[model samples]
Target: MTALTTLGLGPLIPLGEALPPPEVAWRLALVGVGMGLHGGPTQALVLGAAPPGRAATAASTLQLSRPLGFALGPVPAAAVWGLAGQAHGVRAGIAFAATAAGPAVPLLTLRRQPSTTAG
Candidate 1:
Protein backbone atom coordinates (compact mmCIF):
# COMPACT_ATOMS: atom_id res chain seq x y z
CA MET A 1 0.00 0.00 0.00
CA THR A 2 2.83 2.37 0.89
CA ALA A 3 4.54 1.34 -2.32
CA LEU A 4 1.48 2.24 -4.37
CA THR A 5 1.60 5.78 -3.05
CA THR A 6 4.83 6.47 -4.95
CA LEU A 7 3.62 4.54 -8.00
CA GLY A 8 1.19 7.38 -8.81
CA LEU A 9 -2.09 5.60 -8.10
CA GLY A 10 -3.97 8.83 -7.49
CA PRO A 11 -6.06 7.84 -10.44
CA LEU A 12 -7.01 4.66 -8.66
CA ILE A 13 -7.96 6.62 -5.60
CA PRO A 14 -11.57 7.70 -5.49
CA LEU A 15 -12.19 11.33 -4.64
CA GLY A 16 -15.04 12.19 -6.98
CA GLU A 17 -15.94 8.79 -8.40
CA ALA A 18 -18.75 6.53 -7.16
CA LEU A 19 -16.68 5.26 -4.26
CA PRO A 20 -16.08 7.74 -1.48
CA PRO A 21 -12.65 8.23 0.02
CA PRO A 22 -13.60 6.32 3.13
CA GLU A 23 -14.87 3.30 1.22
CA VAL A 24 -11.81 3.21 -0.97
CA ALA A 25 -9.55 3.52 2.01
CA TRP A 26 -11.29 0.64 3.73
CA ARG A 27 -10.94 -1.59 0.69
CA LEU A 28 -7.32 -0.59 0.22
CA ALA A 29 -6.48 -1.48 3.77
CA LEU A 30 -8.31 -4.80 3.49
CA VAL A 31 -6.34 -5.69 0.40
CA GLY A 32 -3.04 -5.12 2.18
CA VAL A 33 -4.03 -7.12 5.24
CA GLY A 34 -5.64 -9.79 3.10
CA MET A 35 -2.43 -10.38 1.19
CA GLY A 36 -0.46 -10.97 4.36
CA LEU A 37 -3.06 -13.29 5.85
CA HIS A 38 -3.49 -15.22 2.63
CA GLY A 39 0.19 -15.91 1.96
CA GLY A 40 1.26 -17.94 4.98
CA PRO A 41 -2.07 -19.66 5.47
CA THR A 42 -2.16 -20.70 1.84
CA GLN A 43 1.34 -22.16 2.00
CA ALA A 44 0.67 -23.99 5.20
CA LEU A 45 -2.64 -25.29 3.95
CA VAL A 46 -1.05 -26.61 0.78
CA LEU A 47 1.75 -28.33 2.68
CA GLY A 48 -0.61 -29.73 5.27
CA ALA A 49 -2.87 -31.32 2.69
CA ALA A 50 -0.06 -32.99 0.80
CA PRO A 51 0.59 -36.67 1.44
CA PRO A 52 3.79 -37.80 3.15
CA GLY A 53 6.98 -36.60 1.46
CA ARG A 54 4.93 -34.52 -0.98
CA ALA A 55 4.54 -31.81 1.65
CA ALA A 56 7.85 -30.21 0.65
CA THR A 57 6.98 -30.48 -3.01
CA ALA A 58 3.56 -28.92 -2.45
CA ALA A 59 5.11 -25.98 -0.61
CA SER A 60 7.66 -25.59 -3.40
CA THR A 61 4.85 -25.60 -5.92
CA LEU A 62 3.17 -22.74 -4.07
CA GLN A 63 6.45 -20.82 -4.11
CA LEU A 64 6.86 -21.47 -7.82
CA SER A 65 3.39 -20.01 -8.43
CA ARG A 66 4.51 -16.61 -7.18
CA PRO A 67 6.86 -16.15 -10.10
CA LEU A 68 4.37 -17.70 -12.43
CA GLY A 69 1.82 -15.00 -11.54
CA PHE A 70 4.43 -12.32 -12.11
CA ALA A 71 5.37 -13.80 -15.46
CA LEU A 72 1.78 -14.30 -16.58
CA GLY A 73 0.49 -10.89 -15.46
CA PRO A 74 2.23 -8.91 -18.19
CA VAL A 75 1.19 -11.21 -21.03
CA PRO A 76 -2.43 -10.08 -21.08
CA ALA A 77 -1.39 -6.45 -21.01
CA ALA A 78 0.99 -7.00 -23.88
CA ALA A 79 -1.70 -8.79 -25.79
CA VAL A 80 -4.27 -6.12 -25.04
CA TRP A 81 -1.87 -3.35 -25.92
CA GLY A 82 -1.19 -5.06 -29.21
CA LEU A 83 -4.87 -5.44 -30.03
CA ALA A 84 -6.21 -2.29 -28.42
CA GLY A 85 -4.85 1.11 -27.41
CA GLN A 86 -2.98 2.44 -24.43
CA ALA A 87 -5.67 2.81 -21.77
CA HIS A 88 -7.59 -0.31 -22.75
CA GLY A 89 -4.40 -2.30 -22.75
CA VAL A 90 -3.57 -1.10 -19.26
CA ARG A 91 -7.07 -1.95 -18.06
CA ALA A 92 -6.79 -5.34 -19.66
CA GLY A 93 -3.58 -6.00 -17.83
CA ILE A 94 -5.09 -5.05 -14.51
CA ALA A 95 -8.12 -7.21 -15.22
CA PHE A 96 -5.85 -10.10 -16.12
CA ALA A 97 -4.15 -9.89 -12.76
CA ALA A 98 -7.17 -9.02 -10.63
CA THR A 99 -9.71 -11.33 -12.28
CA ALA A 100 -7.88 -14.04 -14.20
CA ALA A 101 -5.56 -14.67 -11.30
CA GLY A 102 -8.52 -14.42 -8.96
CA PRO A 103 -10.12 -17.49 -10.53
CA ALA A 104 -6.87 -19.43 -10.51
CA VAL A 105 -6.93 -19.03 -6.74
CA PRO A 106 -9.93 -21.33 -6.39
CA LEU A 107 -7.81 -24.04 -7.96
CA LEU A 108 -5.38 -23.57 -5.11
CA THR A 109 -8.17 -24.32 -2.66
CA LEU A 110 -7.79 -27.96 -3.65
CA ARG A 111 -4.30 -28.04 -2.24
CA ARG A 112 -5.60 -26.35 0.87
CA GLN A 113 -8.50 -28.70 1.40
CA PRO A 114 -8.00 -31.31 4.09
CA SER A 115 -6.73 -34.69 2.99
CA THR A 116 -6.60 -38.04 4.72
CA THR A 117 -3.45 -37.04 6.54
CA ALA A 118 -0.78 -34.38 6.77
CA GLY A 119 2.84 -35.42 6.44
Candidate 2:
Protein backbone atom coordinates (compact mmCIF):
# COMPACT_ATOMS: atom_id res chain seq x y z
CA MET A 1 0.00 0.00 0.00
CA THR A 2 2.77 2.41 0.95
CA ALA A 3 4.83 1.52 -2.08
CA LEU A 4 1.84 1.90 -4.37
CA THR A 5 1.03 5.31 -2.95
CA THR A 6 4.62 6.48 -3.27
CA LEU A 7 4.76 5.23 -6.83
CA GLY A 8 1.33 6.63 -7.71
CA LEU A 9 2.19 10.10 -6.43
CA GLY A 10 5.02 10.73 -8.92
CA PRO A 11 2.86 10.58 -12.01
CA LEU A 12 0.08 12.51 -10.34
CA ILE A 13 2.38 15.50 -9.89
CA PRO A 14 2.76 15.92 -13.62
CA LEU A 15 -0.92 15.48 -14.43
CA GLY A 16 -1.46 19.15 -13.59
CA GLU A 17 -4.01 20.79 -15.90
CA ALA A 18 -4.29 17.69 -18.05
CA LEU A 19 -6.58 15.98 -15.57
CA PRO A 20 -10.03 17.22 -14.75
CA PRO A 21 -10.27 18.68 -11.25
CA PRO A 22 -12.61 15.91 -10.12
CA GLU A 23 -10.27 13.20 -11.37
CA VAL A 24 -7.31 14.78 -9.62
CA ALA A 25 -9.34 15.14 -6.42
CA TRP A 26 -10.21 11.43 -6.51
CA ARG A 27 -6.63 10.36 -7.08
CA LEU A 28 -5.40 12.43 -4.17
CA ALA A 29 -8.24 11.07 -2.08
CA LEU A 30 -7.21 7.52 -2.88
CA VAL A 31 -3.65 8.34 -1.80
CA GLY A 32 -4.92 9.67 1.51
CA VAL A 33 -6.99 6.55 2.04
CA GLY A 34 -4.00 4.35 1.27
CA MET A 35 -1.86 6.30 3.75
CA GLY A 36 -4.42 5.95 6.51
CA LEU A 37 -4.84 2.25 5.86
CA HIS A 38 -1.09 1.71 5.95
CA GLY A 39 -0.47 3.86 9.02
CA GLY A 40 -2.83 2.20 11.50
CA PRO A 41 -1.81 -1.38 10.77
CA THR A 42 1.89 -0.52 10.83
CA GLN A 43 1.57 1.14 14.22
CA ALA A 44 -0.33 -1.81 15.66
CA LEU A 45 2.19 -4.25 14.26
CA VAL A 46 5.13 -2.36 15.71
CA LEU A 47 3.50 -2.06 19.11
CA GLY A 48 2.32 -5.67 19.10
CA ALA A 49 5.79 -6.95 18.27
CA ALA A 50 7.42 -5.06 21.11
CA PRO A 51 8.47 -6.80 24.36
CA PRO A 52 5.44 -6.69 26.62
CA GLY A 53 7.34 -5.08 29.46
CA ARG A 54 8.65 -2.32 27.29
CA ALA A 55 5.66 -1.81 25.02
CA ALA A 56 5.10 1.79 26.02
CA THR A 57 8.71 2.68 25.42
CA ALA A 58 8.63 0.88 22.13
CA ALA A 59 5.60 2.77 20.95
CA SER A 60 7.09 6.06 22.03
CA THR A 61 10.33 5.30 20.24
CA LEU A 62 8.40 4.25 17.14
CA GLN A 63 6.52 7.54 17.14
CA LEU A 64 9.75 9.52 17.37
CA SER A 65 11.02 8.37 13.98
CA ARG A 66 8.20 10.15 12.14
CA PRO A 67 9.01 13.68 13.23
CA LEU A 68 12.70 12.96 12.88
CA GLY A 69 12.12 11.84 9.30
CA PHE A 70 10.02 14.90 8.55
CA ALA A 71 12.77 17.08 9.97
CA LEU A 72 15.46 15.34 7.95
CA GLY A 73 13.66 14.40 4.71
CA PRO A 74 13.15 17.83 3.19
CA VAL A 75 16.76 18.98 3.16
CA PRO A 76 17.84 16.27 0.74
CA ALA A 77 14.56 16.39 -1.15
CA ALA A 78 14.99 20.13 -1.59
CA ALA A 79 18.50 19.53 -2.88
CA VAL A 80 17.21 17.03 -5.41
CA TRP A 81 14.39 19.35 -6.37
CA GLY A 82 16.77 22.26 -6.82
CA LEU A 83 19.09 20.16 -8.93
CA ALA A 84 16.35 18.46 -10.94
CA GLY A 85 14.39 21.66 -11.60
CA GLN A 86 10.62 22.17 -11.22
CA ALA A 87 9.74 20.07 -14.23
CA HIS A 88 11.35 16.97 -12.73
CA GLY A 89 11.63 17.73 -8.99
CA VAL A 90 8.42 16.01 -8.04
CA ARG A 91 9.40 12.83 -9.87
CA ALA A 92 12.80 12.83 -8.15
CA GLY A 93 11.18 13.26 -4.76
CA ILE A 94 8.77 10.43 -5.49
CA ALA A 95 11.59 8.16 -6.63
CA PHE A 96 13.54 8.94 -3.48
CA ALA A 97 10.53 8.07 -1.29
CA ALA A 98 9.81 4.82 -3.14
CA THR A 99 13.46 3.73 -2.93
CA ALA A 100 13.56 4.41 0.80
CA ALA A 101 10.29 2.54 1.34
CA GLY A 102 11.23 -0.55 -0.69
CA PRO A 103 13.48 -2.26 1.84
CA ALA A 104 11.15 -1.55 4.75
CA VAL A 105 8.36 -3.58 3.08
CA PRO A 106 10.16 -6.87 3.59
CA LEU A 107 10.94 -6.01 7.21
CA LEU A 108 7.27 -5.33 7.87
CA THR A 109 6.14 -8.88 7.31
CA LEU A 110 5.90 -10.27 10.85
CA ARG A 111 3.83 -13.27 11.88
CA ARG A 112 1.23 -12.65 14.52
CA GLN A 113 1.11 -14.59 17.78
CA PRO A 114 -1.67 -15.06 20.30
CA SER A 115 -1.69 -12.64 23.20
CA THR A 116 -0.18 -13.77 26.52
CA THR A 117 -1.36 -12.47 29.83
CA ALA A 118 1.39 -11.14 32.12
CA GLY A 119 -0.47 -11.72 35.37
Candidate 3:
Protein backbone atom coordinates (compact mmCIF):
# COMPACT_ATOMS: atom_id res chain seq x y z
CA MET A 1 0.00 0.00 0.00
CA THR A 2 2.69 2.46 0.96
CA ALA A 3 4.67 1.35 -2.03
CA LEU A 4 1.66 1.78 -4.26
CA THR A 5 0.93 5.25 -2.99
CA THR A 6 4.51 6.52 -3.26
CA LEU A 7 5.61 4.69 -6.38
CA GLY A 8 2.45 5.61 -8.24
CA LEU A 9 3.86 9.10 -8.73
CA GLY A 10 7.05 7.78 -10.33
CA PRO A 11 5.96 7.85 -13.94
CA LEU A 12 5.16 11.52 -13.70
CA ILE A 13 8.81 12.36 -13.12
CA PRO A 14 9.90 11.10 -16.49
CA LEU A 15 7.22 12.66 -18.64
CA GLY A 16 8.59 15.31 -21.00
CA GLU A 17 5.35 17.20 -21.51
CA ALA A 18 1.98 17.65 -19.88
CA LEU A 19 -0.12 14.55 -20.23
CA PRO A 20 -3.25 14.46 -22.31
CA PRO A 21 -6.49 14.80 -20.37
CA PRO A 22 -7.35 11.15 -20.64
CA GLU A 23 -3.95 10.07 -19.40
CA VAL A 24 -4.15 12.51 -16.50
CA ALA A 25 -7.54 11.12 -15.59
CA TRP A 26 -6.24 7.57 -15.80
CA ARG A 27 -3.33 8.27 -13.46
CA LEU A 28 -5.54 10.05 -10.96
CA ALA A 29 -7.93 7.14 -11.02
CA LEU A 30 -5.05 4.74 -10.32
CA VAL A 31 -3.96 6.81 -7.34
CA GLY A 32 -7.53 6.81 -6.06
CA VAL A 33 -7.72 3.06 -6.47
CA GLY A 34 -4.39 2.63 -4.65
CA MET A 35 -5.62 4.73 -1.73
CA GLY A 36 -8.87 2.79 -1.59
CA LEU A 37 -6.92 -0.45 -1.49
CA HIS A 38 -4.78 0.84 1.39
CA GLY A 39 -7.53 1.57 3.93
CA GLY A 40 -8.88 -1.80 4.89
CA PRO A 41 -5.62 -3.61 5.47
CA THR A 42 -4.13 -0.70 7.40
CA GLN A 43 -7.18 -0.37 9.64
CA ALA A 44 -7.20 -4.07 10.32
CA LEU A 45 -3.49 -4.11 11.11
CA VAL A 46 -3.45 -1.09 13.39
CA LEU A 47 -6.57 -2.08 15.32
CA GLY A 48 -5.60 -5.69 15.51
CA ALA A 49 -2.11 -4.98 16.81
CA ALA A 50 -3.24 -2.85 19.72
CA PRO A 51 -1.87 -4.25 22.91
CA PRO A 52 -4.77 -5.42 25.07
CA GLY A 53 -6.22 -2.02 26.04
CA ARG A 54 -4.76 0.63 23.74
CA ALA A 55 -6.99 0.07 20.73
CA ALA A 56 -8.39 3.58 20.54
CA THR A 57 -4.98 5.15 20.96
CA ALA A 58 -3.58 2.85 18.35
CA ALA A 59 -6.32 3.60 15.88
CA SER A 60 -6.11 7.34 16.50
CA THR A 61 -2.38 7.34 16.03
CA LEU A 62 -2.74 5.40 12.83
CA GLN A 63 -5.24 7.98 11.59
CA LEU A 64 -2.98 10.81 12.67
CA SER A 65 -0.05 9.71 10.51
CA ARG A 66 -1.75 10.76 7.28
CA PRO A 67 -2.38 14.36 8.23
CA LEU A 68 0.97 14.56 9.95
CA GLY A 69 2.75 13.41 6.81
CA PHE A 70 0.67 15.74 4.68
CA ALA A 71 1.56 18.57 7.01
CA LEU A 72 5.28 17.87 7.25
CA GLY A 73 6.54 15.80 4.34
CA PRO A 74 6.17 18.46 1.69
CA VAL A 75 8.62 20.90 3.23
CA PRO A 76 11.70 19.12 1.98
CA ALA A 77 10.06 18.39 -1.31
CA ALA A 78 9.40 22.06 -1.82
CA ALA A 79 12.94 22.85 -0.75
CA VAL A 80 14.32 20.40 -3.24
CA TRP A 81 12.12 21.82 -5.95
CA GLY A 82 13.32 25.29 -5.13
CA LEU A 83 16.94 24.24 -5.42
CA ALA A 84 16.96 21.70 -8.23
CA GLY A 85 14.02 22.59 -10.46
CA GLN A 86 10.97 20.44 -11.24
CA ALA A 87 12.28 17.16 -12.61
CA HIS A 88 15.20 16.45 -10.34
CA GLY A 89 13.58 18.02 -7.30
CA VAL A 90 10.34 16.12 -7.68
CA ARG A 91 12.33 12.96 -8.23
CA ALA A 92 14.18 13.62 -4.98
CA GLY A 93 10.91 14.09 -3.17
CA ILE A 94 9.37 10.99 -4.66
CA ALA A 95 12.46 8.98 -3.80
CA PHE A 96 12.34 10.21 -0.23
CA ALA A 97 8.67 9.37 0.11
CA ALA A 98 9.11 5.90 -1.35
CA THR A 99 12.10 5.06 0.81
CA ALA A 100 10.31 6.36 3.91
CA ALA A 101 8.00 3.41 3.66
CA GLY A 102 10.81 0.91 3.93
CA PRO A 103 11.07 0.98 7.71
CA ALA A 104 7.32 0.76 8.27
CA VAL A 105 6.81 -2.16 5.92
CA PRO A 106 8.67 -4.63 8.10
CA LEU A 107 6.80 -3.47 11.19
CA LEU A 108 3.40 -3.96 9.55
CA THR A 109 4.35 -7.42 8.35
CA LEU A 110 5.51 -8.58 11.78
CA ARG A 111 2.04 -8.68 13.34
CA ARG A 112 0.73 -11.92 11.91
CA GLN A 113 -1.54 -13.11 14.71
CA PRO A 114 -3.04 -16.53 14.47
CA SER A 115 -6.77 -16.85 13.96
CA THR A 116 -8.80 -17.76 17.01
CA THR A 117 -10.48 -21.14 17.07
CA ALA A 118 -14.02 -21.56 18.41
CA GLY A 119 -14.56 -23.89 21.34
Kindly list the per-residue Cα lDDT of model 3 for residues 1-119, writing each as its tens digit.
Answer: 65555556555445424556675566556655766788789888878777769999998898999678769976876676667776566556655655554466566667667678899
TM-score of the candidate numbered 3?
A: 0.66
Cand. 3 Cα-lDDT:
0.66
Worst lDDT run of 10 residues, candidate 1, spans 1-10
Stretches of candidate 1 above 4 Å error? Answer: 1-33, 104-119
How many pairs of residues in model 2 come into backbone collision?
0
* Local accuracy of candidate 1 as per-residue lDDT tens digits, 26-69: 65565556455567766766776788878878888889996796
For model 3, the run of ten residues with the poorest summed lDDT = 10-19
Top-lDDT structure, candidate number = 2
- Summarize candidate 2's per-residue lDDT along 1-119 as a digit string, tens digits: 66555555555656633567775677667656666677678788888788789899988887898668658966776677678886777667655655665666666675868788899
Give the TM-score (vs. native) of candidate 2. Answer: 0.65
- Report the poorest 10 consecutive residues by lDDT, candidate 2: 8-17
| Global lDDT scores for all candidate models | 0.54, 0.68, 0.66
Off-target runs (Cα >4 Å) in candidate 2 are: 13-24, 110-119
